[model samples]
Target: MAVKTVEDLFLHELSDTYSAEKQMTRSLPQMARAAADPQLAQAFLDHLEETRGQVERIDEMVEILNLKLKRIKCAAMEGLVEEGKDLIDEIDKGPVLDVALIGAAQKVEHYEIASYTTLIALATKLGYTPVLPLLQASLAEEKATDDKLGKLGQAAAIEEAVQA
Candidate 1:
C-alpha cells in the first residue's frame, strides 16, 4: 500500500468498506439487542440485511471492474462504531440515553455515506459504469437509512433532548 492513483484509492476505499461492512454485520445485532426502542432495534436489523447485500455488491463490483481488493484499515469507521457501542453501554432506561444512541447511530450512518460517496465518485471517474449502479444502490440505501434516523429523531425521545 502506497497510495498513488485514484484507482489505487478506489481499491483501498472498496476494501475499507468491505472490512467495515463485515464488522457492521456483527455489530448491528449487538446494536439491535442494546436498543430499547423497538423501532431502532428493527432499523439496525434491517440495515444488517442491507449491509450484507452491500458487501456482496461490492464483491460483484470488484469482479466487474477486474480489480483486486486491497484491505486498508478504516480508522474512521472503527472510531464511529466504538463510540456507538459506548453509547449503548453507558445508556440506561431514559429518553436521554435513546437520544444519545440516535446521535451515535447517525454518526455511523454519515461515515458510511461519506465513504460510499467517495467511492462512487471514484468509480464514475474511472469509467466503471457497471459498478456504478451497485455503488449507487448502496449510496441510496445509506441515504435512506440516514433519512429514517432523521424521521425517528423527530418523534423519538431525542425530540425531548432537543427541547431540554
Candidate 2:
C-alpha cells in the first residue's frame, strides 16, 4: 500500500474502524452469550445495536469518501477476542469467566477509542467538517460503552470471577 498522506490516512483509519465496527457486530454476540452477568450481557447487546447503526454511518462516510468498503483487518481485535476466548475456555464457568470476558471486551473498546480519536482528528484536519460529527458520535458511543463496561467489571464481574 502506498504511504497515505494525512487525508489518505484519515480515510484508511475510517475504513479500518468501519471494519472493526462490523467485526464487533459479530463479536458482541459471543461476548454477550459468554457473559454470566446480566448487565454485561445487556451491555453487549446494546453495543451490538449501536454497532449496526455505526456500520451504516461508516457506509455514508465511504460514500462521502467516494471509496469502496475496504478493510485492513484489525489484528488487535482478533487477537484480543481470541485471548478472551482462550481465557473463557480455561476458566471455570460462572462469574470468573464473565469477568475475564469483560476485561477482554474493554480492551477491545480501548483499541476502538484510539482508532476513532485519531480518525476524528484526521477528519477535522482534512476539512471534512460534515463527516466530523458522524465520527464524533461513534467515538462518544465507544467511550460510553467502555465506561459502562468499566463500571460493570468493577462492581461485580471482577470480584465474582476472581472468587472462582
Candidate 3:
C-alpha cells in the first residue's frame, strides 16, 4: 500500500474499512451480551446484521473494481473494540453499564463514520462511481447507529437522574 496514486489510496482505505467491518462482526455480539438494557442489546444485535451487509457491500466493490483485497488488520478498530471490552469488564451490569455500553458503541460508530466519509471522498476522486452508492449507504447506516446510541445514552442518563 504505497499509495502512489489516488486509486491506490482508495483501495488502501477500502481494504482498511473492510477489515474494520470484519472486526465489528466479531465484536458486536459480545457488546450485545454486555448490554444490560434489552433495547441496547438488541441494537447491538441489529447492527451486527447491518455490519455484515456493509462487509458484503465492500466485497461487491472489490468485485466491481476487479481488485484483490489486501489482508490488513484495522488497528484502530482493534483498539476501539479492546476499549469496549475493558469497559464491560470493569463495570457492573446495570443502567450505568448500559450507558457505558452506549458510549463505547458510539465511539465505534464515530470511527466508522470517519472511515466511510474518507472512503467516499477517495472514491469520488478516483472516479469510483459504482462504489459511491455502496460507500454512501454504509455512511448512512453508521450515522443512524450513532444517533440511536446517542438517544439511548440520553435516556439512560435521564433515568439515572430521576433515580438519584
**Candidate 3, pairs of clashing residues:** none
Q: Which ten residues in a row have the lowest lDDT in candidate 1?
A: 155-164
Candidate 1 Cα outliers beyond 4 Å, as residue runs = 159-164
List of clashing residue pairs for candidate 1: none
Q: How many backbone clashes does candidate 2 have?
A: 1
Give the Å shift of residue 73 in candidate 2.
1.4
**For residues 29-58, could you state the per-residue lDDT of candidate 1 as single tens digits?**
987777777887798899999999999999
Q: Candidate 3: count the clashes.
A: 0
Between candidates 1 and 2, the one scoring higher on lDDT is 1
Off by over 4 Å in 3: 161-164
Best by lDDT: 3
The collision pairs in model 2 are 96-161
Best by TM-score: 3
Q: What's model 2's overall lDDT?
A: 0.82
RMSD of each predicted structure: 1.8, 1.4, 1.5
